[model samples]
Target chain A: MKWADIKEKLRWCAYLASEAYNMPYRSTVARARREQDDLFMLLIFSEMMGIPNPATYYTLELQPIMLERFHDWHTRMGMEHSPLDGFRCC
Target chain B: MHRLFDRRIIFVGGKGGVGKTTIAGALALMAADGGRTTLLVSTDPAHSLGDVFDMPIGNEETPLGPNLSGLEIDPEAEAERHIATVKMSMKSLVAPKMYGAIDRQIELARHSPGTMEAALLERMADLMVDARSRFDLLIFDTAPSGHTIRLLSLPELMAAWIDGMMSYRDRSRRLGEVLKVFSRDQSKEDGFGMIGGSQDEPDDSRDGRIKEILMTRRRKFHRARELLTDASTTAFLLVLNAERLPILESKKTLDLLSKFNVPVAGMIVNRLLPPDAGGDFLRERRLQEDEYREEIDQTFAGLRRIYLHLLPHDVHGVETLREIGEAMAEQLGGAFGAAKAP
Candidate 1:
């Protein structure tokens, strides 16, 4: 093999090695991110989910932007039906 | 030393039917007559500014007199406009099929109780930031005491909420960046992938747009809260009748405004019985008023107070409001100390 080919192979080995070493940290981060995202979705859609959010007016503008993602969010959270009355994402 | 005429922003608020609109209009007239450009805005949904000015004053600024302008805010209309604007903004983020569902969602939110107040407060905040540059005095004839208090308190509440949301976004971004885990795997692996963004489009702008919106709103709310709480620049003129309920309500309002650091410039005691009317019924009513006035003096001690007598004439048109304005001249103008309310 050419010298450049050997160097490229070595670089790939190092890259994969680093990724493997950081696997535990990556999983923990992924879990943390999932939890954070769940909390955030809850904060924004708590009113829709039947939680009385006193600050609903302040969050109303964010609803349209979050609508498309609502489908994915509810389904991922195992909601059989859309929690909001008259709003069917399915 | 808060002078009524010296403040740039004034909110005239009180219990319903306490002549807050008339008082606010009178103050605006005085400011205009003093050569200060004035805008009289009514945030009360049951608007009588048009009746007070005897002219059609809508949402936009309409010239009432020389250097005086009027605008009446309709909370329901504002709420509709707000929803429409949000819908327009989300057009690119939503699919054509999802429009009906999204419209229904926003429509439900529009009918919510706090929605009207929120709309009114947002318009008030917008006026505060936008009109401060053009007008020397911005007089807000707010709704009744309870409604106005909620509107005033919302600026700080909204600012804190936006701040919390932005900080959360920042922390989440930092977590990904610091861990060097910012990858493109979410679109492929996660169930909660982005909504309508194209695959070729970078993931940064969606959250960036939310951050931008949050930042803009935060600045407006922060500026509004700053202006409202700044005792030197803004003053809340409390108007109330010399009756029992209004007096008690005014005391509660005073406490609430003080707690929020919103300075109460003075009190205008409306509809006091005149002494010259000599009848047994009049005498008894005046006696009751005298007692309430005493309570007012005790409750609102150290605050400059203006006492206005019951006028048989309707407080309409420039001539009537001018009469009320002149009555306020002595105590409020500070230039004319001996004059009294008619």
Candidate 2:
């Protein structure tokens, strides 16, 4: 076999092995990702939280995209001792 | 003089009631009369273009004369237009059951204090980008110094703010893609019922629409900052009378503009006392004016200073603007050469 072909095959095998090793931690990583998103959304809505952000106008375009996950995000935030715990969206 | 008119973009600002609007109008008219297409824009909320031109000028572009157009930006109206756009996108993405709540949220945002300024800045960026191809020169008549300074400084602040948001977004987006690949089936099995879990991953991944929107805005602000700081193609002019307050205030404003890297062209010493005013009281007033005038000369020796004597009447009508324009052209290099660059 050519040296280049051998090197490519080895890289593919290493990638698969790393994927297998990361399988168990996948859920934790997902939860962390969700928390990261929640933090980002809070910054966008900081004005509504009584923090004055002049750049709030720039966040309006992202509102619709986040609308779907907001319920999932905010409710978890409500249990995590956030100021949003007592806040009602409606 | 020749250098001032050669710029592609010009901003006129000073203390309130300092005749900034008049100077900006006359300059725009002069550029147009010189056969260079020009646009005069008023960024002051209390617009006087309608008063200055003796015609109704609202948010839309209105022709002042041959090769000249004017626009008065109404911040409230601009904010409304922005809300309408947000509402359109929200209506499609939000569920019908949640429409009322989303509507109220948007309405609250509309009433926020900074909404108008945000909208105005966005509109200004749009004009700067859109008019690059259509006009030979653009002149902005800004509000009094403080407000204009705040508005001009926003692009730098906003660009930095957006950069922080962009880096955070990039991290989250990559994590999202990883979750889609590794935990998709397990998330379903865990019974953690996210309505979006079953749906397509397009909000931050797959589609990446917000990245495009953010990129467009970041690019616009960068371009606006570049144009504002370019001395060869952009210049900031201050219009003030020969008075103590105006002179002191102009010095402070000039310092601020220089710190921001904006090129300060010079000042127009408007409403000067005529030498021939024959009266003890008038002559006394003239003596006071000369002291201030001398002070201005000493303070701003490096700047191009043009002194305009007080006109006999309140400046009005196209004929009046034309006369002032001619004086400006005569003093601004004595004769405006056909100089422009893209």
Candidate 3:
């Protein structure tokens, strides 16, 4: 999946989690989700920005697992109606 | 002053991002102003004592005001110290070949569940006994409420474990001594003495000194629990703004604390809209403030309530702290004054 697609899905997942917890979708939730996505993107951006990935680097192999966990968590929490649900590429 | 104050340890704890440090610091100042020598120590791993006081408070105690000092205890440093103590004790008994394995075990012991709280409790117990003569009051600016409870409960949990270990240690010591005597090797005498130096060794002269210290810690825990429940000695002044999210979180925290039998002493409604006559924006803000203030009062009923006007800038430095302190003192009714004698 492309980075943009992953970002969109994660944002939806974040909103779903917040809604499940009965938290308001205010600036705090937006900021928290944005921060989490920013962290996720920073690592990939670092690698693309000429940072060396040694033999132990396995970022490519972990993307599917991370997405699966996010999907599993949302599904288990009964948050299947999120707008970005059908956007998963994997 | 109540006799409970003499043997009490006060721990101020709440959720993170709540103004626990500020309230703890202000209470210490109030106690000092009331002529009690108070030591406010932070047991939070992520400390904000320096930020709260706007002064450098390293590992060692730094004087904040007359009769008031603050210390920030670093849990990592404490864990290291505990690991070393355990390694030294284990080295005296286990075979030389097993020393490396034993050392690794001691290192891994730091990662065990509740080890952080246990080590912190041991350090606190030591400090309480060591400073028994220096300070009259010990105020802990504890971590969030969950962590604080875990830390406070460490003494009882550790005492139970110590009881079981003491019997095993005593048997091992006797067996080592007997083996040494049969071998007739005086060189092993000193080695066998090491195993006998467990913490349970009863001293005839001091009688129950160690037991007294443990008992004092247990009493301190009970006293802290009481003060938290009692509205007089301790007051949980929650600092919350007039926002829905923070208000909800504060109310939830109050509910949890009440459920756990920890009293909500009072609520400090911070950053409220001023009563200034202004445009529509100000009017809307004022309406929101009124709504939230009513919500706070209704949610946390049966406790004293105070409102603090929103300040333009962040509260920092001694000067700002003093100004905020004065404002808070006024709202809460003049610092050390009796709580309306109701």
Docking class of 3: incorrect
Off by over 4 Å in 2: A1-24, A79-90, B177-200, B203-207, B334-342
lDDT by residue for model 3 (B67-138), tens: 888899876777777567546654564456656655544444455545566557656766655565798778
* Shift in Å, residue B188, candidate 1: 17
lDDT of 2 at B175: 72
Q: After superposing candidate 3, which stretches have Cα over 4 Å from the reference?
A: A1-90, B1-9, B124-132, B149-237, B255-260, B277-282, B334-342
* Fraction of native contacts under 8 Å reproduced by each candidate: 0.33, 0.36, 0.00
Each predicted complex: what DockQ? 0.40, 0.24, 0.01
Candidate 2 residue lDDT tens string, B1-342? 656778998999999998998888888888888888999999999999878888888899999889999999998998888888888887897567766766778887888877888888888888887897999899999999988888889899899988887887888777767767764554544444443344544563623776787888899999999888999988999999989999999999998898889998877888888788788998999899989988987898788777777788888867778787776666665432321110
Worst-scoring 10-residue span by lDDT in model 2 chain B = B333-342
C-alpha DockQ for predicted model 2: 0.24
lDDT string, candidate 3, A1-90, tens digits? 999999988976764564444323223433343344334333322332344432101122222223323344345336564213222312
Residue B229 displacement in candidate 1 (angstroms): 1.2
Which is better, 1 or 3, measured by TM-score?
A: 1
- Chain A TM-score for each of the predictions: 0.79, 0.57, 0.33
Backbone collision tally, model 1: 0
TM-score of chain A of 1: 0.79
What is the lDDT, from 0 to 100, of the residue A69 in candidate 3?
34
TM-score of 2: 0.86
- Compare candidates 1 and 3 on DockQ and give the better one: 1
